[model samples]
Target: MSAIIQIKNVTKEFKVLNRREGLKGSLKDLFSRDYKIVRAVDNISMDIEQGEIVGYLGPNGAGKSTTIKMMTGVLEPTSGEILVGGNIPYQNRAKNAQEIGVVFGQRSQLWWALPLIESFKLLKDIYQISDSDYKSMMHLYQSLVDIEPLLHKPVRQMSLGQRTLSDILAAFLHNPKIVFLDEPTIGLDVSMKSKIRILINALNKEKNTTVILTTHDMGDVDALCRRIVIIDKGKMLYNNDIEHLKGFFGSYRTLKIRMDGDLKQQAEVIQKELPDFSVSADEEWISVLVDEEKSKVMEVLNQLQKSHEIRDMQLEEISTEDVIKKIYEEGVE
Candidate 1:
């Protein structure tokens, strides 16, 4: 498949005012405001194919939002080029808007005092959707969200989850070829989040709509995205499939054992046997860290069972959260 979204060496910079400290210094600086250039996105480049769902993630001040804004044509890049569906988003915003949809978790595009159905009607008019297309789209969206009961309620009177669901429906009403979802499930309950995920997956599969999701919620990344792009300090850190990202840190595993006898004694014995590994124990449980390249978990367990009765054991792979956290702490290698 051809690349639907191409970002080439994109950089976005901002000139922020520098303020002086204390009353005397502040008074002197009021006449002349100094400024410094801060690059929120620096020399970043990637290509997203059509019909692909990608998770765009980063820590706060890591420029995730800045990148999205540039892609959506809300902000122009300081340098480099961004092409969505073969059009320059910042230059051909009106034409690009017809082919894309956007949803911001903290912002609403619906009328505040209007009924949900009325809001939908207004959007249909704004988009100039045909009667048959509007009805068909509503039918499909309602199947995912069950928006029947909430249609009569005013948007301002709905709950956070309800409002978000409504907003998502509104975004897709036009059936845009691409969509950008920014923290769509933020501040929602578990059930609401699940519903949102289901809706997103259904839309992607049914329409082949390309999606760019920006969120801190790992659950969203795990459920919907096979590929993820992470950035920090305005630089791209990692861009690959979820499994490949996990395999980057797959050399280590955690082994937890329940002992029939004294856990501390067993811990000491294991520690002696594997001097290079880190071993610790509590009342009834012992935990050991093993580097898979150097030692096998089964070998360690068999050696322990010879001296002490092993009640139970569990070997766990490191979680995606821990792996991403390590990247943030140590920077990408």
Candidate 2:
């Protein structure tokens, strides 16, 4: 119920060699003392409360991974302080390991040759989980998903989705106070993604475990997180609830339409014509994010209908994904 993780003015810096352009420069670079300091996390601070699921979001090359590494005690911060459950992560890594579990996407903690249940049992032993606690976790997993089929299957034989699901379940098997999940639903289909999201939601509710999730998937953010922290270029941008973030772009509406023509070409044309609004297209829909104060939804639809044959059109409110994308492009004011 209190702040379980407190990060204060933490900074992580890396020293990179300044390599030269030419062959002679390359040879001289080995002996060269030139180096550049890159700050991956720049004086960012946040508090994660007990039993809260916080979405840690950023674009690629943003400081998400570096922050995670510091939290997990894989790397020590260059400056400032961090306390995970009142213990410094880097200083007390062994003790910290006992209290937190982590699952990195596509990187299985489960043994490849072992049956899924075998891997779970192995984790139980490693974490020293008791029989009663282990049974409770198993019961919880069964309630949300049918695990009987996947239990005996070797982890190597399971699909990407199945492996990811198994890895998440294993992470929670120890009943750790905190869990770090990095892109748990990556490379999964819609059905699998929905199932995993449901499982994560249920687990957090039932167990009251604090989760720090680093993901690019907006669906994950919408389904699992109430509070989100977004960062870019090693600097904190927004740390607030989803609604407050959306309120920044409150007047925007997503005009979704089904068209018969080339979606990519039509998207380019629409983007060129309406330089202010954002346009995106997929196989099924061309979603134009229109600022309602500047242009009406119907007006945008009418313009789209001019070149692209609109099979079906709907005016929907902007989604969390759209808002996040806008923030990524222009950043928060």
Query: CA lDDT of each candidate?
Result: 0.89, 0.90
Off by over 4 Å in 2: 255-288, 294-313
Q: lDDT tens string, model 2, 175-283?
A: 8889999999999999999999998888899889999999989999999999999999999999988788877865888888887778888888888988988789999
**RMSD per prediction, one decimal?**
3.0, 3.5
Model 1 regions lying over 4 Å from their true place? 258-289, 302-312
CA error at residue 48 for candidate 1, angstroms: 0.9
> How much lDDT does candidate 2 score?
0.90
lDDT per residue as tens, model 1, 126-154: 88899999989988886777888889999
In model 2, what are the clashing residue pairs, if there are any?
none
Tell me the TM-score of each prediction against the true structure.
Answer: 0.88, 0.86
Worst 10 residues of 1 by lDDT: 245-254
